[model samples]
Target chain A: MQAKLDKSDCMFLISDEKLNQFQQMIDELDLFTLVLPFVEESYQRSIWILDIWYSISNEEINRISNPENTMIYPYRNSILGIIKTLPIKRYIQLALYENERLAFLCAIYIYNELDDFISKKMAIKEEVKENFDALKKYSNKSLRPFFDSKYIEYENYPKKLAMLQNTVVNELHEIHKKYEIPLSWTFEKAIDDASKVYEAVFGLINDWGGRVP
Target chain B: MIISNQIEHLKNLYKDLKFLEVIQFGTITLPITLQEKRYDDALICYQYLASAYYENGSYENFHVVMTEYEKLCLTYGKDENKMYFYYLYSLLQVIVRDFDAAVEATKKSIKYAHFLKYHDLIVVNYYNIAAQLVHKKELEKARIGMSLAKFYKNNICESNITIVRGYIGALYYFATMGNNEEFQEVKQVFLKLIKDRQTFYDAKISFAEAILTLNLGQLEESVIFFEYAYLRFKEQQNIMFLINIEEYINNFNLGDKFQYTKELREIIKNSHRKPLDINNVKSVLSDLFEDDTSTLSIKYPNVISKELIVQHVEHALQNNETLYCFHWCFITDEIEELFGKLFVEQLLFTLFETVYHFIFKHNAEVNVLSKNEGEAFIRGISESEFFELLMELEEKLQSKVVHSKMGILEVPIHFGFIHSNQLPEKQASYEQLTAHADASLYYAKSHGQLYIYN
Candidate 1:
């Protein structure tokens, strides 16, 4: 079962729901009321996803190489796998609303993985290695401050996230000619891939430092 | 579906009082609700967000959110939405101590309620109006408002808290006006309404009681109530009441406690109402709106009803659980009128702290559970261990010297308890156990006993 939390709950956080809520929301994105807004959301969602994927992997940086098809993303399986492994519907939050809504959908999966590790009484050496592998490749300085244990300041987390939001906004505005702006991805896929980096830090902060805001 | 799902989860969070989470998730979905033309869902988002901000003591955020809520209601909302809009608007004004504006806002809500024929909303708005009016010292208008509240308070299922608050609002009016009989009447009914359960507004009642006793030349008598109300309001972070209490306590000479009280007040007043730290986070997307044709149909554009509309609520009764109930009463029943002035006043003033501190050891959980008044339980301990703790409390209470200005030495308190574990069957309904506790409490008080247990 997922935990219920709130602003008052501080680091523990708020909004409790089941897997179906997340699933239902993702399914609903396919039925957008407005075509323009829906497609725009899809584009923004893809931008966020590529930013996240690029942040972790040594992919063609800031350039989405969807030469085969504008709609078909290279990491489609991994993105879907991340969502499939996630216990709760966290990325559902990313599917609608903002131009760039980032939730670190993988945070849910990562947190759940941590939970499994803890309950199974397994050392997190393997998980930590996987996390660091994802972490070290980031070209963006968004996760710069939160990289080291000594630098993990909970008070500064929101500020850093806000900074990341600004960075994402600027990136969206430029629509870097270096990257192929995918026209083929669905809103559901875009949303599934959106939301990056912070929640991973959020999960780690919770797991190691037990500090969140 | 995303907006609706988020709204559904936000509603649940609000219901669960996970306000921080409400703010958390509400922040994410509110824009979606607005963007998707799910205005009602958007309104729900605003409602939860505003409340969450308020509950979290993010007053600046609260005001910001309410302003947006009001804007949303006016721009896209229909009649019923405007009614609720003004109702919430009234609350926003009240928080800032703008009594006149608050009263006006409430009356506006009442106007909408009248149009919608929502008797319950009318009742609540009248109560809100009464609260603001009382603060403004408009006793006659407040009385009328109170009467209106009482008339429409006939409706049942208005959520247990709202009904209780309506009564408390009326209680404030009656108590403030020195309508002692009406005050007592409303208080008795309210007490009956929440005998076995604690309420969020329990401190507000203490505040009213403090004001009533103060009016009756019982300033010293009012100290305990004021102190209780102060602590509780501080706990609740109810700034409005805390400010009101600060005004009262300025006249009170609580010595070191007053200084501590002043500091505590500063912390509470500053805590949630921090100026919006907008510098750290500016809106990156200032105008996300497309100004397209609104997905929602606009209706009932006329803001007010042409004719005065009235609706009556049908009266209904509702009332609760029990385990160990310890009723701690002060030992002052036998005092003469002459001694009452010097002894009772000085004694209360001198030792209320020491006494409460002493009792808090044994009765803090019980006091909080009962809101200082019904049924409480003790778990994770054997019945014999409980008795041993009780006996130890009695022993501690036997001799204690409280230093004060008058050099007042000591005071006694009566402890009455209902130990259900000691009962033959140890299985009693909530009512039976509480009635038994109340009986023992009264018995101990009348008999002038140190300890009485059933």
Candidate 2:
């Protein structure tokens, strides 16, 4: 059931080898195995991931086909689109199964890549910066740059990185309170961990001669 | 400490249904709780945010907030909060029309509540389950569920709000089953409970009073009660209850139905008139019943003919844009015939006007086609827009009031749609488009959907 549901709409966009490597990473991280005990819960997470992929692919396809219809900033669109897919129910399910957090992390990592690609392709840094400024009003000052270069320290061992991630999560909680952003501690932790995973993946790809495909 | 105080402030706003304010404050409240590493406080904020989003019809945001709430419950929340989470999840499912899932989730809530020995939570879950059963039309089972709710209310926690809600649920069940005596009994109890209380339950009491009077054949009094209820519901933004009142009004019957409806409309229009004159009410009964097309004319314009449909179809095909053909058919022909051909035509026209407004609100283009056949077409619509239109139409049709010779009639409408792209349009022609849409309409009618797409 997991495999059947794992057939993402965006799977065709990537090479088979790249897809295999992504799946291997997911397996190595023991994401699906952690969710194995809860059938309905796991299935819901799978559906959510598929939905996110479907949306991202649709946006990508639309952008490619009709460049004139680009109304929203690509980076903002990708971030908001991915966030939209992770509603409260899925968040809880992922939180319940610790391993499932990896799946969320993987999704964010992929989206970060897409965001980068769109930003470079369209040369919309000024527009992207303006959009980020708008988003900053809703977020805290400390956690404003939610994704940053500090997370790309792949040379730091996983356990050390995990400790660093924990600190970021703790900081985010304070930021949330200071800013009065309506978010759960669990959600804050999940998002922080996802950012860590995203940075790690980017660091890994960089180490592998930056051959993302 | 300050965060809790802030939460209390937002809680007051939430109770007042000041959703926008609550949401604005929540942005700060949620982050503060999280930043302080107060998972429990964060959970509470999520609950408030979720409810606000749900009430405001921002399902996507609600889903996001609820997910966070659920996560917190699993991670750090106590059993009571977990039970509350399930209860909220069930309510959200019901709003989205997932009845089976709602029932399952409610059962989970009840289980958790029972484990925690929280009688109030258990009773609330049972009440919700009963409400879902009522929507399912399983009245007997709903009655049993309501009985359980009442039993729990009596035994453990007999709060005024709980008792009022219990009575309201009973009233709804009895009214739906056409048990007028039982309905009146429940209404009396409900009214007595709110007789002297300076509470927000006045709107609910007035609603119960409206139903009771309507059942007792006191049409004028019922109309007044209904108007009062509508005003209160609108102010509170209690859309669900408002929809219920609209449904009840749709089935209203007076001796001279047409004249009474006209007078009711006039009274509603006269917003400045407070403590309405009894003479105006009496004049409604004596006034000559004129079939006025004025209201209908103002609401609906540019009624399309069959020839016009062909032109629209040609234009859609030429532009390579998607055309959404919607077919609406009344369930009861007898009711239509009783209302007279002209009156029925006017009603259909008004329905078209409502649909047009609804479509345009979603930024979709709509054109009324073949007014006599109750057909219309929309173009350049997305799936989400189509679904939103269906929801709006369902609410409209359920609540729309029309007077007929045989008392009052709530004509059940069958709606179906087909996309132009779905048609076998080797050559884009009206014959092919209509034929395909007609078939989809037939399927939707048989399948009992507001609208089915092909």
Docking class of 1: incorrect
Give the residue spans of candidate 2 off by over 4 A.
A1-213, B4-28, B48-78, B157-167, B178-200, B208-222, B237-241, B247-454
Across residues B179-277, which tens digit of lDDT does each residue of candidate 1 receive? 779888888887876675534556878889888877776766677788888788777666666777777777655434444576756765676655444
Residue B392 miss distance in model 1 (angstroms): 95
| Cα lDDT of model 2 by residue, A27-46, tens digit | 43332122121212223233
All models, DockQ values?
0.01, 0.01
Give fnat of each prediction, in order.
0.00, 0.00
Candidate number with greatest lDDT:
2
How far in Å is the alpha carbon of B142 misplaced in model 2? Answer: 1.4
The TM-scores that each candidate's chain B achieves against the reference are 0.52, 0.45
Q: What value does the lDDT take at residue A99 in candidate 1?
A: 19
Q: What lDDT score goes with residue B407 in model 1? A: 64
Deviation from native of the Cα of residue A183 in model 1, angstroms: 66
**Where in model 1 is the C-alpha error above 4 Å?**
A1-213, B1-31, B52-58, B155-161, B184-199, B251-454
**Model 2: per-residue Cα lDDT over B271-352, one tens digit each:** 3323212221111110011122223322444433334555766777887877776767666566566767777776776666
